[model samples]
Target chain A: MAFLQPLIFAIVTLTVFFLAFKKYRVIYANINLGKDEKIAGDSGTRFKNMMLLAFGQKKMFRNLTPAILHGFIYVAFLFTQIELIEIFIDGFTGIHRFFWYVLPLGGFYTALISFIEILSVLAFVGTIAFLARRNLLKVPRFHMDEMTGWPKLDGNLILFFELILLVGIFSMNTADMALADGKYGFAISGMLYPLIDGLGDTTLHIIERFGWWIHILMVFGFILYLPASKHLHIMLAFPNAYYGPLDGGANKGEIANMPRITEEIKLMMDPSAPMPEEDPNAEPERFGAKDVTDLSWKSLLDAYSCTECGRCSSACPANQTGKLLSPRKIMMDTRDRLEEKGAGLREHGADHDDGKSLFDYISTEELRACTTCNACVEECPVSINPVNIIMELRRYMILEESNSTEEWNLMFNNVETNGAVWKMPASDRTSWINELEAEAEAEDA
Target chain B: MSELMASGQEKEVEVLFWVGCAGSFDDRARRITKAFVKILHHCGVSFAILGQEEVCTGDPARRSGNEFLFQMQAITNIETLNAYGVKRIVTTCPHCFNTIKNEYPALGGTYEVIHHTTFLQGLINDGRLKLKDGGEFKGKKITYHDSCYLGRANGIYEAPRQLLELLDAELVEMKRCKSRGLCCGAGGAQMFKEEEEGKLRVNQERTKDIVESKASFVAAACPFCMTMMTDGIKEVEKQDEVQVMDLAEMVAKAQDLI
Candidate 1:
């Protein structure tokens, strides 16, 4: 088995990457199933957006306590990965602490190890804090009607996974410190070394080896689990933040900037403008999105990027008012529909029809309840726009289906016939002027 | 102003004041229209009315997801404005201000649109308008409710507050003001449809914050806000003590214009 180490590592690494990449390709292809949306321009602005939002976690701090804990776990986890590089090198080369001599920076290595040691412990604490927030604290934002079952479990599992990984690292380091005769970096690892003292070299070696293997195995497990987990945000947050609107204007958070319906209507209004030349066989342009394929690519990407955090729903006035519409549920339903249809495609190849769409999952009641106040868009830490999705569905309902509430239909009729929402005529739109003029005349007299 | 003058063939009017459907039709909101017009007249501002030529800007229609009707209304109004060669538009209603300023450009109706608060603030800045040193509202505790369209949607918080400061009112803020301000439950065309069943009505929750501030007056910038806040105040049985007034009405009262 000693001679089989390289072979085992090769086979395991290949299988893990193969499975992860295969799933990733399927998601990517499914996301491409939507209509093309142009989020590709302005690399400079996009880069700045990615840096500020993804790297800086800019919007996450609106809820301060959670934001700080999130940053703690987030920043410390990245630093702890420096030690993972050391572990990976050691795993492959069958040599421990390979970086200790590879760089040969004696003083710097000591400082780096000390810094990483402190962070690993902080990461442990942060993981516990997150777990408490989910399980014990029961944050109002975390627990929603739709976030039951898998969503609730997935959140707990992520924190649990991180907690165990940190324990393994510290256990390995404690054994390593004891073996080196109490010399330690940060010594968070060595605090427990005294408990198992005088256990003999072979026993300590077995414990060290056990911790190392467990930590490495869990890392691989996380890689495989992430795409299926709400933990997918651990990877997709980067691109989601990057793809966010980079204009940074007064209304930068607004993603209601759709391909304007007004433009096509403007063309139809111009009597002299020749009818737009189109191939006679070409399908009519979609009025509004009815299905996933009719949605813009960003809408699909947004579904994938949702971390099920419920920040949007928590901020939503509609949700706060006890409306059936929860923006988090909207995204969850969208992602569920996407996964259902994507699975069908995977099992039956391209052109496979599920004979169902996003509308079957998301209801008109949920759609109409939205105020379109952009609260969800603003509060979304990942910049996912559930309002835009609602607007898209609404467009389909109004234009294609023509099924709307009686009040809505009345307003629609008033707008079309009278050119205003009120029952008053459009010619009487400025009747206030006459009334004001009469009052002014009486005052003057 | 006639089309010739509106086209800059003469210099009688510098801007066209677009009083939206609410300002024109709703009896309570009509007073806001009067107050704003009085201020404009007192300042001798070069302004003219679109009169009956004006139609709804389709803000409610567009917001309620009737894009076809919205475009019809928008295109007709844009044609009317463009025909008059209207350059700068000022509206007492933030809905009209937001739609004409933000939404109309997409439909080929581009103009420099100003909300009444900003227009009044600009008048004060230019010394064209003046506030009484100690008007009836002097030292009165007043709080401004941010309309979602004006405050969060277009970032116009300070202008209305600036106007309140000039009115010599003791400007107090609610627990939630400015960007974090709660909706009056009337934005996004909720003014038209009935509110859905909820644990608490949004405006009532907002009025609780206003009542908590102990302000005698709640200043609003939008007609919808005025309506919702007025309803909320009445719901709490504070209609007698707490009055909901528009910014224009407050200024007009201070100046003795309305």
Candidate 2:
């Protein structure tokens, strides 16, 4: 029956990994539903962006107070992985603190555990502060209109999970120290041992076993919950940053040229040009994005990578001026619509339609309210371009549905007729030159 | 005065003044165009306009999601520009500057494009242009409203500011300036259309920053921003105190040329 312990640990770990893998596969497939777009820039630029934005959290420094608090949790979460290796090995070999013997140096394990102990303490404080910011302090960005129910709960849930995980870690370390009687000499737990030392050996052993199990089980639960939570940003931010627009791309206010439209326009403008062959069976290409399938895969990745921080919304001109357009809500709605369509795809075949499009999730008013000022794009910490998604959706509304304001329609008509935004003709484009010459003559006179 | 090239003149010049639709046709923006042209003449830098040959760069059309119309204009303009072997161009409007500099390369129209402020900065840097001592703009309190296309889009926050720095006026900054600058409610072709449902107008919100800055003269680089900021000042009932002046107009005033 001694094998039962390792067997249970093995079964639990395998089940968690399988479940996480299954969810991840579905997410990957859902993201692939979007149209393929070649991300501009070489590997060097992408790698540099990933390292600076995702790993170094460079953008997080824009707001100093939250960045420092977040840094405590982020840095601790990274160092916690070192201690996790020991936990997994101990669980498999039925040897508590297995690295104690496996590691080459004598004091290395003690030093590493002490370091983890110090980090977990900071993580515990950071998690509590985050919870207070959400519930007590009520940070405006965290409690916006879109963040009412699940988003609010999701934010708190992760913080609570971190707190519990830290509690479990401290429980295991302190009890193990009490049992050791100054042998291992972990810094934080050594100080804590006196409080729990009066509890006899048997009780201390049970507490250690209980805490060890709880910590590992909580990690497994976090893994399964990640794909369903906005916490997925923890994994997706890297790839999203890597595939973000380069310097010469959208950042320079360059709207992507529609190649299909370009080809058609070229053909229409010149009769003498050679005509290209068209396939009869091929579906007509869409001018812009109408749904998740019409958007670029990079846009879908942006949806998954959104942390729901609402920095974009906070900085948006439209949102700040009390308009309906919230860039954060755009990413959230895209994710929601994608998930709905993804579920439909799983049930029905490739041609699955729930009779709902992105318009059903995002209203026309919200789409139209965007100024495309790139404030939202610049404010996003993870390089998620809400403007890209907004532009695609707006393109769909205008080109596919011909849904537009009368003013926009008039502007469009003017441009088509006169080769300018206003109703002025091309012949009058250089009229200012004459006005200048007349003004110069008047000045001389 | 430097010689201004006429369309199909067959004469070469140092640069081409791509007078945008607003600069050419719009009454208010024409003053900016004239101011820049005067500065060009003051410095004796030879330049030309395409006259009837130049059309809109289709900045508004593309931003409004009318790609077909935008491309039509883009193609037509590119043909005219490429045919004339136009290599260097300068524009008073940031919209035209951004479109020709960033978006035209893909459609086979590439040229050395410079915004009017950047062009002015170069003139000042080269010592080709100089200002009179303490002219109309001297010692005035001025705040520059950043154009979205010129600032964040093109990473040109400093060029306009650099031009402003040469003025004897005290240059004060608004709360939201540079990369974090608020929109004057005129970007994305919004100048031609009414704003979508909002509690307060976008430019009104931006005006609050200008008002907070307490500057008398609002310096603007883009024609659209100038219009929006002027309207915002009117909305806030500060038109009497706060005046919106373009960089070229300010520089022209300082040089006693306008």
CA lDDT scores, all candidates in order: 0.80, 0.86
Q: Please list the residue runs of candidate 1 whose C-alpha ends up more than 4 Å from where it truly belongs after superposition.
A: A1-3, A252-272, B1-12
Candidate 1: RMSD to truth: 2.5
Q: Interface RMSD of candidate 1?
A: 2.8
lDDT of 1 by residue, A331-410 (tens): 88888888888899888987888899898999887888777666677678886888778877887888888867888888
Every model's TM-score: 0.94, 0.97
TM-score, cand. 1 vs. native: 0.94
Best by lDDT: 2
Q: After superposition, how far is residue A342 of candidate 2 from its true place, in Å?
A: 1.5
